[model samples]
Target: MKKHIFTLFLLFNSLVLLAQESYFPERNAVWEQKSSSDFKIDSEKLNAALDFAKDNEYSGSRDLRIAILKGFEREPFHEILGPTKKRGGPAGMILKHGYVIARWGDTKRVDMTFSVTKSFLSTTAGLALDQGLISSTKDKASDYIWDGTFGGEHNSKITWEHLLQQNSAWSGELWGGKDWADRPPREGDIDDWKFEKPKESGTFMEYNDVRVNVLAYALTHVWRKPLPQVLKEHVMDRIGASTTWRWHGYDHAWTEIDGLQMKSVTGGGHSGAGMFISTEDMARFGLLFLNDGKWKNEQIISQNWIQQAIKPSEPNVNYGYMWWLNRKGDRYWEGLSENIYYAAGFGGNFIVVDKENDMVIVTRWLEPNKIGEFMTKLKEALD
Candidate 1:
């Protein structure tokens, strides 16, 4: 009898966990942003933001140092920031009835943004497109690149469109299998990728790290400045991100398009990881992008660049340059348009831009609900 009861209890816990993971409590969510009578925002939804902020540690900047000794690396999360300092969440908090509008957890603080760095890189490519530097997106990326594999039969047909879309069917051991984990985590980050055979290219959209490195090679080789410097002038500096945040190429400078000193990218690298900024500042970026790359009447990132960056290039998997699109339901939710896009990172770091509603939501945390769950929640909120 006790065994049966234990099995039942375990089953119940499993069901609850599954529910939290898959089933979203939509009606229970509310908004709280009220104060501005001019803006067409749901006061109740804004109120929900207020309630969300009560729990997270967003009122402070956490610091941490990673030192190497004894041939090992040591990192402590809670102790990194050395006890959190006091900070106001954000002016007119959206979670708690229009009080604070910002949040930051340990992971969101000093942690690195891995694949996110790609978004920045792609944005630079957009600027190049808008500035008339690259001319057109149709040109094969291999023309500017100088790799043997890129020139071979399959890759020769691949275009810039393919690389940005991750649709480049470059033949490598990485994408030719089902268990991607068995292949190296990153070809550019470390020497873990075990490449064996080569096959046809530009067939499917699979996550490829080395493809980004190839893009860096193409862009930086043409621009004549390292990808980091190009990013500084084209994206970061324009976005008012002079903060300590920055991008790092790779340790193998020969293989890396941009290289200076060897160090972990401040917050994260590009792609899944990259430039780190305060959640407040990150929201500012989204605000600028949502408003067509202008802030206080200054054309930071060109309007053309903004459109090219967020505008969907293809509908295969719903991606534009480096941003992701909402998958479920209609495009218009609440006052937001279907054109809304987001910069998502591992561990639930999100920078959402809803141009239709003039809303830019940014969330940073070591952990949040699962990726799909959180995105669905935000979509539901807008809907």
Candidate 2:
């Protein structure tokens, strides 16, 4: 009887603690700035977290367009997706209890957030699933994308889940780019790449932009509208994201849909066109996920979809539906919960969501190697 009473007391306390949590931000939500003392965070530790972020900035090329062109080493880099813009220096913001605890750099500057766009693409897919355009993620993509794109026997075996998890190895040329040309075997010669044995679909994971673009192309067909528009109406606008952001596709990524020329968006800023968004906007996105896709009283992304979206793929434990998850013990700070997942981009753009702490972190242009340390210091600041 004593044990039962103790359990009941603990449950009541948990419920009371939950009741004290802050409300989710509404549309055009007011930014509430609070000091470390307000949250019981150690001021010195919070300062250390800020200093660590300031000290560890992205040391890569300042002119991101030039950097991308030089990195690709191919003239195809000249093919602009949408509109390329100059990126700013390291910047970030931290939010606890839906209030800003810290921020740095140009939070409003619009800059390319490379592969982090993949998570947006994933959200679009979730929208499709919610609308019933997709019967099941396990269904073969070729069944719906009946075009020759997925006609090849090997490609036909690829499922939507396989594509979402980066395990599909889908082969084809998209927008004048070949599948094998993307992130080709680092040690192999041209001949070896051309004649390499194909792995079965869903058997191996490869981070190829070409295949990622394939997902964008397939999704564009399903929606019959520009993905940017889909995203705007469904997510960004709903989340009260700023109007400055844009999603871009390659110059040749345009296709005729319903008698209109529609551009199929790229999954990342790989060739210099992806999500050009502000850090605060990205934080809003993170906050949405942190709240289990709820914004105020409305459910934005279904909790069931969120669960499936974060489920680890067989081949990659650290990835899920385009989101980078910190599932493994060694991948993130030990002090943080394993439930933490983030949308990461090249040149160190990141939006980290921690449900347990009701925290959202947005960092732009931080050194990738120092993220764990940054996270560790941030965790220490709590209480």
Candidate 3:
């Protein structure tokens, strides 16, 4: 009887702690802020970290069209196939226990978020799994997508898990972008890459925009609607995200679904047209993940999916289901928690979730190379 009472007491304390961390902002409402001292964070150190982020802006043209072309200069035939935007100055927010502890620059400015859209793409897949639209991740893509995209024998073996992990090695052209041409290895010419034997679906990992778009396309067919709609209905609205955000696809990516035309969105802005969102919305998304897919009393996404999404895939210890893990791998950040996972895009946009610290850090237009040092300083502030 005494042990039972003790267990109940611990459970009660846990509930109280959760209530303390449950603050979430309403739509268009002023987000509540708390001082660094309120959370026992060193204000001086926190300011230093923010200053570091401000001092190191992304060294790219504000005109993203030029930035995209120049950044992917090595990739043959790479061009802006969709909409591009002129980015705002460096912006970000630091959320501690779902409350803003620090903010900088133009957090309200909506800008193109490049590959960070992959994380959002993967979230749609997670939603599908939760809703029983997808039975299992281990199921073969060909089983669901009977279209010629997965018709070939090699492609037929590609599973949803493989695609989510970016190990599918799906070789094909989608929306005028060829898999071989997306990001050809520096060591090889176009002829060599195009003629090279396709790696097994689950064996090799290659970051190809074409393959990522293929996942988006497949998910669209499965969901029977535009992915942005699914996200807005099930996620953004529930999380109180602003309506200014937009998800776009290539101009030619239209498809007939249920007797109506819908555009299949890209997983990233490699060829343009992905998620264009404000920093605050990105923070809300990050907060949802930090809380393990819950918003107040509602479970927006299943906890099981969140767990699987963050688990490192065998091909890359630093990558999960479209999320970048801070494991001691090629992309690992020195002096940060191994549990830190993030949504990273080109031009240094990132939504970093530090679960151990109950914090989410959104940094836009910071130098990509300086993230490690920035994170180290942020961690020091917490200490």
Candidate 4:
């Protein structure tokens, strides 16, 4: 009788575990939706949160080309070097336990997701590490690329971790964009920045697209294939993301790899060209991270990589491997969990992953300043 009781206890635990498993949408299958009531969430508060997002759409021009140029007007010589798309109005998805709890606007409309591309770019590096293509993040980048990109004394000292953390301080030019020219200090003129000594790598944090592109270029050589293909075969396809998503680089960012000329993609759409993806697909990505890089049964990206990717670097508590953390820092969203991390882009694209709450939030074209408040509102609803 005691043996039979043990068997029943095991069966009961298995059923509970099965019940708590997340629902993953199959390729081309309609994603399942659940009412807020199903999750015991306050329906009125949830609707109010969605209404707030809709009411406060991004202030940028719908013609993102104009918005991109105007937004970066402070930077000299900035130009649209790749493709740009007119954006759709305030589109988003809120997923709880892998089922859509709330959705608004054109969730299927593909739009440019500027610097959020950096998070995806970093994913490629994680893949390389997982596959033994990169022995370690601590490995010097110069060891992999003996070419002049990492030639200088300062650049040679940079490691994969430095680039991933956006603290490489890599000095030099790539594809006609100078490292200092990307985003110069507000108080300094062109000559001041151009001649200034670069900070020691991994000691300072700076958000320069030129340096970001260098990382992309290095990873291209590391993977020996276009990043989009690597991502598609290994990640996006595996996650059942829609075929509409695209990754792009500047028009002149082509390089010869494996006897074929391929475009080395940028980590952002700063001067245009990064990720062009729909809201639903973005939610799918957030879901993958929410589950610690697992999709249903398969671990597409190792949990070790994801954990490292979200760890706050010494230089920036709010940043980790190109993903933004909600930890105490300049960019922290007050009243939110410090454990939350997200991918944010210009013109207000965000893919927020809330592991503590078992939720993912994807919002596009919402005013950049409103994210903190928006998140707070969403949290209130869930509470």
Candidate 5:
């Protein structure tokens, strides 16, 4: 009788675990508030987390829009494809089990997510791979880009994986921007940048926006359609993202595709005008990835693709594809799982996803370095 009771106990525990619904909010899902007691969260710790985010908010340039344009090469900035937009202040929402636990500032205000746009760019590549638009990640990028872009022998050796991992070291100009000029080393002068030897593809991991833009251009040629449309039809709309988000490219980035002049969207807003999206839409995106590219039982981005995208590349362990990983003590925090990964951008925009705790923390302008502190305190609140 005791043995039978033990069997029944195991069955009951399994059922309980299965009964817990994995929340996926609808297009009109409201931010229904619940007491800390209901979610087993520490009220004190929760308040502390909120306080930390509020206190250490983004204290950068107040007019980043004007400042960013002035900082870059003026002529090229003016020649870029799309118009730049103004940015907003510190704001974000913390979602636990698909419900907003805490939100601060203006969560609905759309803002430039900087390099966080790389994560979306990476997702587009995942979609391409899923639909067999490209055969494999290891395939030579030159195979798809028949144009003289990857003409040189060195650049020809670059693979899709190399580009996605930011180790391609792809040379040549795209949309009037030189590879070296993208993000030159701070210590170096123009001559130093001009003379620097380029590393072999997949060897060095330099965060160059030009190389990233090159990846965007190559993907554009493959799809023969604008990236924003691909994203909206496949991923964003399915995930219930708002129409406020806009992916902008430069002025000269336009090309005649399928008899129409289409702009090749950029990977980020390095030069200006990248993904201007709201925190709520960003949360939905984070939730999609947290559930491994599935939305309401449909596989939007392949699970295999996501697994590959997140794995640590040999060049940089803390970076996978375009997403930032928490491996090797980078972005590590106590009381949080080591598997935590996030989409980080310039000016402290972050969409931090913790799969273990089923949480997605979106913060805009929260002081880049202080993210670890904020997350550490926030995780402690989850009890």
Candidate 6:
């Protein structure tokens, strides 16, 4: 009887702790916070894993299973997420071992990662290339654009690369007020915010969510199926990600976004954060990327893509197609010589690939305002 009473008390205390995390003010969902010690993988082994992560974080490796349990609170790196005039939180870090070294986080974890979803979306594009579903990135965007009539002359001049590079130069604040009425009404708006479509296509990175959303539309057309279907065969099937892993906008486990899925501009419309997965799954993803798209014997993502994806070739932004570049760093690689490439996600998510060291470091945070400093420190540590 004493033990039963104690267990109930513990659960009650956990409920109270969970109750503290909600902001809805009305529907407060209670959950207990676990510490890193509660994780499936041991934290002590972290250092031992760094060497492997430094070596093969790109490819998906099943034999490597050193998952780390990182129980830490998340702090927003954004100056905006600072004190609610109520409380404050700070970012924390931990490292994990497997094929490559990685760090995991556990705090008010995993908010929507915004444009980072573009990287996932780009995987679908890469698969299209792999399966020969789509012919080329050189194709004209106007061809797939809903308004095919206006696609003549100058509009046709815009290539899919322009769209990928965000060089198409569409300057409307894709997230703000609605000035654009030429297109259809965006989905999921309780209110109608207008957007002004920037007349220019590539002069500057004046972000237009609609532009990337157009890629969703194009993928739908080229694949002749929803973007979700292609993602299943190409990425999910190959990676062995958790079933709990879900790509939002995909209706079913089998049925994909068949019709008009990618029609809207995803940047503003679909923040990259919608896709959810466990931190370990994310590390697997980072590893696959680091490995240049090899998951076991299956060459899921192509070598040409791994090479092209990492290359710093875009004209305007330091950003690559969907992948971000860590190009400007010193000529150092795991105490060797190799260029570093990475998939940088908004809100402090990074899959840092140190090819020479054969290491891939993946991090998640509410906002690690410390990213810039942290990366610098990390690179130094590896060197």
| Candidate 6 or 3, higher TM-score | 3
Per-model C-alpha lDDT, please? Answer: 0.49, 0.84, 0.93, 0.93, 0.82, 0.48
Model 5 worst lDDT run, 10 consecutive residues: 73-82
Q: Is candidate 1 or candidate 2 better by TM-score?
A: 2
Root mean square deviation (Cα) for candidate 3: 3.9
State how far residue 260 of model 4 sits from its true place (Å).
Answer: 1.1
> What is the C-alpha lDDT profile of model 4 across 1-383, one tens digit per residue?
99999999979865764468788988888899999988778999999999999999999899999998988888877888999999999989999889999999999999999999999999999999999999999999999998788997889999999999999999888888988888778885788888999999998899999999999999999999999999999999999999999999999999997799999999999898999999999999999999999999899999999999999999999999999999988998998899999999998899999987788999998999999999999999978
TM-score of each: 0.63, 0.92, 0.95, 0.95, 0.91, 0.60
Off by more than 4 A, model 4 = 1-19
Q: Is candidate 2 or candidate 6 better by lDDT?
A: 2
Off by over 4 Å in 6: 1-97, 100-103, 107-111, 144-153, 171-203, 249-273, 329-338, 366-369
* Candidate 2 clashing pairs, residues 3+ apart or interchain: none
- What does the lDDT come to for candidate 6? 0.48
lDDT of 1 by residue, 1-383 (tens): 99999999979865663343111112112322234333323446544543453344322232212211110121111122111112223221122121223333421233444455667677667767777777777788667666554676777877777777666755532112222222233335322333434333445555555565556556665675666676676655655553555466444333333553322221223222245555544554565676676655567677866666655544343566777665334332333346668776643456777554445666654233333333344444444
lDDT of candidate 6 over 33-131, digit per residue (tens): 333343233444544343333332222111111110011111111111110111112222232222322333342333333456677777777777777
lDDT of 2: 0.84
lDDT of 2 at 368: 83
What would the per-residue lDDT of candidate 3 be over residues 1-383, giving only the tens digit for each residue? 99999999979865764567557999999999999998779999999999999999999999999999999999888888999999999999999889999999999999999999999999999999999999999999899999789988789999999999999999888989989888888784689778989998878778988999999999999999999999999999999999999999999999888999999999999788999999999999999999999998899999999999999999899998999999998998987889999999999999999988889999999999999999999989888
Question: Model 2: which ten-residue window has the lowest total lDDT?
Answer: 74-83
Best first by lDDT, ranked: 3, 4, 2, 5, 1, 6
RMSD of each: 14.1, 3.1, 3.9, 4.4, 3.5, 17.2
Q: Deviation in angstroms for 180 in model 3?
A: 0.1
Per-residue lDDT over 1-383 for candidate 2, one digit per residue giving the tens place of the 0 to 100 score:
99999999979866774666654555565777888687667989988998888888887787887767665664332344455777888899998877888999988888899999999999999989988989899999988898788887799999999999999988878887777767655564756776676689988888878889898899999999999999999888888888889888886778888999998988988676778898988988988888888887778888888888888888888888998888873355566678899998888899998877778999899998889889988888874
Better model by TM-score, 4 or 5? 4
Off by over 4 Å in 3: 1-19
